[model samples]
Structure formats: structure tokens, C-alpha cells
Target: MSDSDLYATHTVENQPQVLLPYNLWSADRMLVHAVQQNHSDLPTSTLTDFGNIAGDQLMNAGELANKNKPHFQPFDRYGRRIDNVEFHPAYHELMGEAMTAQVHAYSWKNESTTGSHVIRAALLFMHSQADAGTTCPLTMTHAGVAALRNAPDLPRYWADKVISGEYDPRSIPASQKRGITLGMGMTEKQGGSDVRRNTTRADIQADGSYRITGHKFFFSAPMCDAHLILAQSTKGLSCFLLPRILEDGSLNHVRIQRLKDKLGDWSNASSEVEFQGATAHLVGEEGRGVPVIIDMVSLTRLDCMIGSTSLMRQALVQALHHTQHREAFGAKLIEQPLMKNVLADLTLEVAASLALTMRVARAVDLAKANQHEAHLSRIATAIGKYWICKRTPAFVNEAQECLGGIGYVEENILPRLYRQAPLNSIWEGSANVQCLDVLRALRKEPEAINALFVELQKAVGKNSAYDKHIENLKAAFDEQETLEIRSRLLVEQMALALQGALLLNADDKDMAEAFCLARLGKQQGLVFGTLPASVPFDEIIQRGKLEN
Candidate 1:
């Protein structure tokens, strides 16, 4: 009963320790298995090393970066229009680590390698868990390569810097930098996702360069050296590469209006900008902006799936960690039947998500060489993006609920995760947009539907529940005229079937069966933790938990 006793009226008894310095790769059994299944020559050490950093040091860096948000510096001390966004040192550190790890450059760098997309996807999954904000530039830089290929000269001029695996944060001409990052400026105030309605105009000058005159309502990652933007040319809307600095080392005419105080992603800076006759280089054929940029959009959509999945994984891990240590009603929370049901249900979700995401990554890798794979990648990206992003917010909310009141506090990472959970679903395209894209794919590319069925057929006889689910999906397509109205439901069923098929073929038979039962067999309730009582909760929890 001394001074310390008086201050501590009660000890902090049941609170679990903060989750840090854990191995993200080693602890994620499903991700590890998915990698082994997808890649023939796995970069084991590289992934293991990245997992360690992402789990510990990178997590701390993310906290610091978010706590100290980026500042917009529109003018210099002399009132010169510098138009730069200054970031915390931690954000730069995260960017450097991401670049050095080759998350942005991996697939393109190893284009000929087998399963390159799978490897890169795995890396992105881990990176996003640590800091989702920095992933914006990383994703854009990686996806920009796809758009750059359409312009022959643009690739030679910018490809080297984009794939340099070095992050140059200096706001200077691209030529002077050791490396560079790319950004996008598409949506306008008038047109949110409808790029065709954009008011931006691009006029050809005496030189080959074009002068772009318009404003972008959402100019993401404003500090990027260059952006692939769309503007109206004489022909029609066209894609252009607009740089922040001109070739002669003078700042371009791009004017940064102000930054968007967003709901989340505090570490990244998203700004509204106006290009006042800014010099730009046309990317592809005039009036074909949407077709040309679709390649970049596809890659970014895949990243959306990966990012959301990462958020779910981290949230589930946090929940498991909490329940394992915390106690109530004279027993550990993990041992409680209801909580175990919730935890096990979440475990199955993460496993199925990893399986489906990795499977799509493999499809992307093989797309160039195989026609079926190409079609599958086209359709599956939309489905995965739609479903995974849609599920993340609720998944994170459930995880937050596991920790009760403490989880809502700012001091914990759960609050940040909860805020970030909905961003991926809204970023690339909202749920409705994704569903429409899937319908468009079905109408335009018949081969895409065939490819999807071919993939689902791989596990046809593995489980009766999965087989029945596939049959139901096939039957739903007969009502083609109603697809647009019921697009969300159609896409969701397609997604669940894909996940069920992947899990059925995976190594863990029991886990696969449980997924089929709960997700497909109608043995579960509407929300998570509704798995049938027969499911082995203890084994599933053990499989998913991080060892303390």
C-alpha cells in the first residue's frame, strides 16, 4: 500500500500486449501456402525479410507518418509557385523500403519469370498491412508501366526511372532524379467515374508536346514527378503524360489548389490541381483514352483486392492476439464458444481471400502466353476487386468489436484500420462500377465467361457444396436481360464460387470443407461467426493465430 499502489487502484490485468515485431510471412500460414502453390521458384528469403520489417519497424513508421500528416507547400519563400507536398520522414522511409523491396518494379522487372505477379502480389499484401497510405504511389508507379507501354517513346524516356528501384523524393525534373514515381489525374468535379464527361482540353503546340488546360478534382499523389492524365484533344478525350517540371528544369504550369482532408490515408497527400496550359505528351492514339488507360486500371484494381485483403488479415491477427491474452467470465476470450466461432469464421475468410487473390495473380502472370489466362485475368480482377473490397469494412468492424472500447481509441491501430477499410472499395472503382465492368466483360468477351467456368471447373468434384454453388452460378446467367439490375448479386456469387473452388483445391481439406459449408452450403448465418456448430473452431483458430 505505497505510492505506486495508490496510483494503480487496479492493475491492468486482462489487457493484451501490443502486437509488433511479428513475422508477417511466417505467421500467415495461408499466404505462405498460396505462394508455394502459385510460384515455382519462390523468393523465400526476400519475402521473409520483408515480412520481418513490415511486421515491426515498418509498422512503427506507419504510425508516425499517419500521426504527422503531409503538408502542402504551394509557394516558396519568395512567393514562387513551387507546388510541392512535403511529407514526414517516416513516409519517405516507407516509400524507400517499398521501392528497395521492388514492390513497384518486380513484375515488369521479371516479365519473363514465372509467377512474377504472384510474387509481387504477395509483397504488396504484406506492405499494405504495415502502411496502406504509401501504397498509393507504389501501386500507381507499378501500374503506370502498363500504360507507358502504349507510347513507344515514353517507355524509353521513363521506363528506366520507373523501374530503378530507387525512390527519389526530390521535387525536380525527372531527368535529374535517380528514380521516379508516377501518378494519375482523371476524375473531375463534374464527372466522378465518368471520364468521358471531363472538361480538360489539350492543344498541340508548334513542338510535338501538347498543352493541357483543365483541373482535376482528385489529383492523387501530387508530389509524383509525372501523371498520366486525360484531356480533350481535337479528336476527342486522349491520355497524356504531364510532368511537374519541364525538361529545362523549370516548374511546369500545374497549380496545386489544396489538399483533400480525407477520411483516412493520412500519410498520403491527395490534392486538387489545375493545369494552366501545362506541357504534356500524348500517351496513345487520340480519342482512345479509356482503352489505353484500362491496362493501368486493371493492375490497380488487382492492387485494390490485395490491399483490402491485407487490411482484413491485419485486423484478424489483431483480434486473435487480443482474445488469446484477454480474459472474461473466468476464462480466456479465445476459449469462449461464441468468440471462438467469430475468430474461426474470420480465419476461414482470410484463407479463402488469400487463395482467390493469389489465384488471380497467377492468372495475370500467365495471361500474356495463354489466351484463357488472359480472359480469366480480365474478368477475375473485377470480381475479386468488387468482393474483397466490399467485405473489408465489415471484417475490420468485427475485429474492432473483439477488443471492445479500447479498439475505438486513437492510441490503437484498430481505429486506423477501421478508417482505411472502406477506402479500397471506393478508390479504384466503387462496388457498382466494378459490377458494371463485370457485366461489360461478359457482353464484350464471351471467352471471359468460358475462362471463368474453366477455372471453376478445376474443383468440380472436390466438394458437393462447391459443385452445387457452381451450378447455381451457371443457372443465373440465363437471365441475361436482368444482369445489369442484379449485377452486384451476380458478381458476388461469381466471387464466392471462385473462392470456394480455390479453397477446395488447396492443401487443407478441413479448412476447404468449412469454407464450402459456411460460404456455399447455406450452413451459416448472414454475418461472420455463423459457421455451423460442426466446424472445428479450435483447429482453425490454431492455424490462423500468430505464436506469441
Candidate 2:
């Protein structure tokens, strides 16, 4: 009593405990429904297990990894040029579990499955909530398979190891390891997004290989077994696979100049490296680098959408959990009117984000067998990538506001999520790049536009606002000269229309109405908590809450 009254006067009160171990799959009603609606064949037990681990141990590891950022070890005891990046054990723990669960190989390994991409997308969506940094290599490793396909022999030797779901962090030749990861190097200092402006050179050698000499401004995941890099060859820009360690058990000529001090993604390592006559093998024909790398880039862009959506889901859950337990002036925060409105608005965002991204995943899955789906995947990916990523920073910030001061603190997860939100938008390509890609697709591939409209047309008679939005979107496309200047506006409308149509087709009419009212109708506002007063705020908030 003496100690409690003397120094413990400011005891912690009116605060919620850290969110405990919960099943991310079962807790997310919308995700579960989306999986069912998409007709995914992946067993529920798999997701249930990953969801539990992601919510508990993986989340804890994320904190520790971020707190102790990766250390760059460029030399050994004898001052040898090691050029290695070492991470905290927590980072490795997260990677091990993620790889063990087949987060990087599910879609590729289960190519015969109907909804393979959808199932894998769901895994990534949930796993990223635990820690997004490690997913960088996972994404690169997954997407790199696409680019490697251009060289059939490369896949003959690498595909098995890639789809093995074995996590090998050792800096050794791919042949010597149980499994291996692949990364990419594209952007140079002179041109961030313009691959044509790159100055790196690749010279063909007598052994049919090439010697690459230049610097990559952004060499992602330098610790990976190999990286697909673009360099200027005698013919033109070409793609090459540069390994970190040669098969002879010696370090390659690739030198890690330094690691970038990025804003977030602390658990990952991105470096700047110079190729001092690095031995490499071309992936595709010279002068066709853009097309080869574009395949890999498209897959990465899909992951960008997934990562942002995951961040939004995590932020929303954190806000909802905090509000339910924390008290304000006289009542719990969740019971407050304004707070309920904010949560309901975020609920709509998460719902729409998941719907659009999962739908895109299905399109990607079906594209291999259907032409319409292939066109839709090509065009819709750009639209969703541009809009969903553009909306995440604001979404996370509004969720943070529900917790007041605590949300901004480093000890809480919201701060980390906030820092991770912007990376997705800038990673594969910025907003403008995505917008331009949409325009390019529309111009070069008219069938893509037709496919997108056909998909949007399914919800034509469902809602008046949605129908009108579709009409306006179609009319917006008529002005060819203004499309470039108004690309963002056009892409945004496309994204909203796509999300609105998907929601209208969903079983939850109330969620669909709320999304259309807040996003498609005239009642929308610039910030969160602006849904019409007539909407069922408490019902929506209740639907969005996690059971645990």
C-alpha cells in the first residue's frame, strides 16, 4: 500500500494489452469469405496454422528484427572482402516459418490447382501483417521465377530448388545449398525507373558467359544466391543472372559498396554494389531486357498491392482492438460516435482492398488458361497497384488516430506499420509509373480494356451509383490527348469502379452499400470517418473486429 500510493500513483490504466495470439485466418471474416467466393482449394487448416503463428511468434520476431536492423559485414578477421549482411536471429526465425509454410512457392508448386494464385496471395496477405521486411526476399524469390523462365536451361537447374520451400541463408553457390533465393538489380543512379538509361555494360566472354562491369544503384537483397540484373550489352539492354558466390567456392566479383539507410523495412537489406568484371549468364536474348524483366516486375507489383493491403488490415485491427478496450472521458473508445465512424470507414477500406487484390489474384490464376483473364490481369493489376497503394498511408494514419498518442510511439506496432506503408508504392514503381502503364496497356492492348469492362459490367444493374460510375469511366477514356495528363484520375476511377463492382457481387449488401456511398457517391469526404450518418456504424465495426 505504501509503495502503491507513493511511487505507483501513475500506474498504467485505461490501456489495452498487446494483442495476443489469434488466428488471422478465422478472425478475418472478410478474408475467409473472399477465399470461399474465389473458390480456392487450399485447405483451411494450412491458413489456420499460419494465422496463429503470424499473430504470435512472428509478430514478436518482427519487433525484435526491426529494433536491431541488419548489420553489414564487409570484411572478416583478416580484412577479407566478405561483403555480407547479417540479420538478427529474429529475422531468420520469421523467414524460416514463412518459407516452411510455402509462402514463396505455393502458387508455383501447385500449378495444377484451380485457385493457386489466390491461395498464395492470401498467405502473403496474412504473413506480411506479422513482418513485411522478410517478405521482400520472399516476393523477389517468388517473382524471379517468371523471368528465369525465358532461359529454359536455367529453370531446369533452379526450379526444383526454388519450389522446395527450403530457406537457405548461407552465402554459397545455389548448387551447394538446400534451397536458394533470387533478387534483382535494375535501377541505376542516373535513372531510377527508366531502364533504357542504364549505363552498365556486359561483355560476352569466350566461354559463352558474360563479364558485367558497372554499378547498380539499388541492388536488392544482396545476400541472395543470385540476382537478375539489366546491363547494356553490344546488342542492347539485356538481363543477366549474377551470383554472389561462384560454384568454385569463392566470392564473385560483385562488391557490396554500402547498404542504404531506408525509412522502413529495417529487417531487409538493400545495397549498392559495383560489378568489377562479374561473371554472369544472360537470361534472355540481348536487346529484350525490358520485356523479360517486365514479367518479374508485374508479379512484384501484385505483391506491392498485397503488402499495402496487409498493412491496412493490420492497422485497422490494431485500432479496433485498442478502441474496444481503452476508455475515454466516460466510456470505452469504441462506443464513441466519432470513433465508430472512423472504424467503420476503415472497415470499408480493408474490405475493398481485399476484394480488389484477391480478385486480381484470381485473374492471375486463370490467365494461364483463359485469354479474357489474361487481358484483365494485365490491365487491372496496374489500376489496383496505382490506387490501393496510393490510399494506404492515409488509411494507416487514420487508424493510428484512434489510439491517440500511443499509436505514434515506437513500442506500438502502428508506428512500424506506418513506416512500412510507403515502401510498396515506391518499390516496384511509383504512382506515376503505374498510371502510365495502365495507359500503355489500354492503348496497345485494346482487348484488355474490353475484358475489364466486361468484368465491371457484371455489376451494372446492382447499384445506381456503380452504374453511373462505370458510364463516367467509359466516357473518360474517349479523350486520348488528355489521358496521359489525367492518368491518375482515370486510374483512380477504374480502381473504385472495380472495387465497387466486386463488393456489389459479394454477399454483404451492407458493406457494398457503405463502400459505394463513401467511395462512389457524392457523400465521400477527403478523410476517414466521413461515411453518411445513416449507415450502420456499429454493425460494420462489429463485423470488422477480430475475435481474439
Candidate 3:
């Protein structure tokens, strides 16, 4: 079949219309194009490595570049054309933890880095296939836990693939390279942030499977081969691994009713999926999916942080390039003090964000290595997710402003970054949810808080920037006397402290400290802003000092 015909075959209009528009072809093209662009910067050796692992035909940069040129006809609802791109089946084999590390590093570079998502999707897809005993190189932390609970030998299977790189998912003819997408199903028609009120239900079947029946208000890649679905199991609110395609390799009973007209990540599909007796395999166990998924969710949260950092970095680079050459008022924009400060601030914050994210990634790696501190790693992940998710959008917005009107145009990547950054915090878990989790984790084991503080103290002792920030944080903590106030202050301090520890561990101690300093300064402003003017500044200072 011709490329056009193949693309046309994937359109949703041709399929039985479910609740949301099902356009796998468009989504596929977007993902393919993004992945193609992602590999553009790689050397031939790396490309060959990817091809060797994937065992499928890998498109080189030249072919990908040719395919990525915007075409008007195959545009999605968002007006973004699908870039015709293809990846070798071995892409999954090539994307192991090291690749994740590389992608994470790239995210630190700038906002235009589209490789993170590609790597992420590849990892998750590989993860699913690996879990099913199909050969794939990628490994996940929760996979072991799930294996212990369900499939005991699964970890060994994963280890062999990772160590030898000899496994091929396509080798199992019955198990093809299936497309996978990750999305949160927390939102409901009634409440979004309040997931406790979610009404999705799962009824048990005689065959030991589940008949999941509920409406997912916002589902990403609903038509993908597999989904990490959230549902209310018999135990409580939980998550399940729901395959879009059944064991018979047919589309499940779930219906995709509508595709959301989102502002950014336009190439990716976000749909409202309605499950009508959809069959699902319970991941982990009953009442255990929430925490289990939360662990997995941390990976995505870290991705969001890194993705935003990458986008901001790209925006800053582009802005700098444009400002350096484009003269305004007979002087380059970078020559002006105001523009120079903006540039400096953008550069600094982007660096800080990158440093913070990498720290989290390293912590995640450490947790995986030592397995004993998995909980601590989860907390660190939350901190990373919360801090970066909150800052990325602001950084993107500020970076866009530096470009003035040009940044708002779709032609420039800033607007897309800006639109996509917010979804990072909202997905995986919102900022508030992360903060609450931090609070809950602290409450569960107060020693974790002290341990975190000690880690920060050690980091501070080594680095001057961190030392200064810690002093400020100590002062802020000392000021709050009420238990309620102390807990809140500690939560904020914990975030800063963890950020410092991660950065220190990641070998970027200075940038992490600077970010904590910025955060401390901002928090002070917020505290001062809310205080009564009649109150003495000294009293406020005194209270802050007391907490430390």
C-alpha cells in the first residue's frame, strides 16, 4: 500500500465511531515524527545501536528530516500535520535505563526536545511487552514488585534482556510491537483534583478477569494497544492494566467518544474513553494499584520536569539566538540591560530546573539500585515532580515573553511548550497532590524528614550556595511555632532540601542550591505579601528565626 493509503487506513472516521474520535494513524504519525526528530542529533553509532536492538528498519536523520516537513492534508483537529516517520521494531530494545538517562539529560537542554516523550512511550511499551514475557530491554522499578506479587520469574526475564540485549518483542509472533500510551484517569465529570470521589467501578468476572465499567473523562491515547488504566476496584480506588486490544487481538469494548482540542502536545491524542464492560487484568493486587501506580507515576512526573526543562532550554536558546542577531533600536536586544537580565534569568532558571530534574532521576536510579529506600525515592520523585512541574510553565511563559509576539506563533515552538508544560503538573498528579503526598509521607515517618534535613545539611556543608540557602530555610523553619504552620513550612523546606540533595548527588550542587535560594526568596515574598502591614517586620523575622 502507498504511504497515503496506509495513513488513510488508520483514520477514525473509517472505524466504528466510539465516544471519542479514534485516529490512530494521526497519533501514530505525530509520535513517529517526534521520535524521528528525537534521533536527529544522534551519531551513526547510536543509530546503529538502536537499529541493532529494534531489529527493524531505522530511518536515518536525512530520511526523517525529509519526512518531517509539514504537510497540510493529514493534520489533526489541532491543525498540526502528521509527520510521516517510522522506527525500527527494535526501538524498544535500544531504549533502556541508559537511554532514559540520555533523554533526561536532553530535557535539561531546552523545551524543543521532543525526544523525552518518544523515549518514554518506547520505555512503557517495552515495559508492557517485557512484563508479558516478550523480550524488551527496558526495565521499571515497579516491575519487580509486580513480579513478586504476581509473576515471580518476570524479573529474571527482564534482567536477561537488560544484561544481554538479546531479547526481541517481535520474536514472539503472537506478541507484536504494540503501541502503548500512559495517561491519568483521576478526573471525573464531577471532580478532577478530588480523585477520592471518582465513581469508576470494576466488577469481578468468573474467569478471574474484571469487567471495568466507567467513563474516563480525560484519557490519553485511548486507542493504543495498552493503557495503564485507573479504576475503583473492590479493594478501593485503584489502577489496572487494560489492554485496548483483547487476547484475541481485537479492540476491547471501550469506546472513544471525543478527542479533546488541546492547546499543546497537539500531535498526541487526548480522548474521553467510555468503558462498557471492558476486560482488564488487575496490576499488583486489589487495593494496591493506587500506591503501585503512584510509584510508576513518579517516572512520568520526572519526565514532565525534564521535558519542561528541555522545552525551556530550547526556548531560551532560540530566544538568545534571535536576540543576539536581531537588532532593535540600532542595538541588539541582548545589548539592552533589561533584555540582558531577562536572558540571564532565563538561562539561570533553565539550568536550575535541569539540575533539579537530573537529581531526581539519579535518586530514582539509586532507589532502583538499592531497593531498600524505595519509599524515600518515591518522596524524592514527588519533590522533583512538584518543583519542576510548578516551575516549567512559568519558565516557558517567561521565555516566550522574551520573544514577544513571535513566541506566541505556532511557527515558533515556545507556544507549544507553554501549552504543554501546564499539562505536566496536572497530569501524573497535580502540584497540590504532590505536596499532600509529601505531607503524608512525612507524617508516616517523621524520621524521613530529619533524614532529608541531614542530607541537605551535608550537601549545604559542601556547597556555599546550598549552605546559604539552608541557612535561609532554617530561619524560615525556625520562625513557625504552631504545629500546623510548622508542618506547612517543613513541607516547603523538605522540597527545597530534597532539591538540594538531588542536585548535590547529581554532581550539579551549585545550580540546585541556587534554585532552592530562588524558591526560598519567592516563599518569603509570599509570606510577607499575606502579612498585615501593621505587624512589625522584626516580629515576622523573629518568628521565622524561632522555627529554625
lDDT of 1 by residue, 394-436 (tens): 9999999999998899998889999999999999889999999
lDDT of 2 by residue, 453-526 (tens): 99999999898889889989999988998999999999999999999999999878889998888789868678
Selected candidate, larger lDDT, 1 vs 2? 1
What is the total number of backbone clashes in candidate 3?
Answer: 23
lDDT of 2: 0.90
- Structural similarity to truth (TM-score) of each candidate: 0.98, 0.98, 0.64
Q: Where does candidate 1 stray beyond 4 Å? A: 6-8
Q: Which clashing pairs does model 1 show?
A: none
Please name the candidate that would achieve the greatest lDDT relative to the true structure.
1
Quantify how close model 3 is to the true structure by its C-alpha RMSD in Å.
14.6
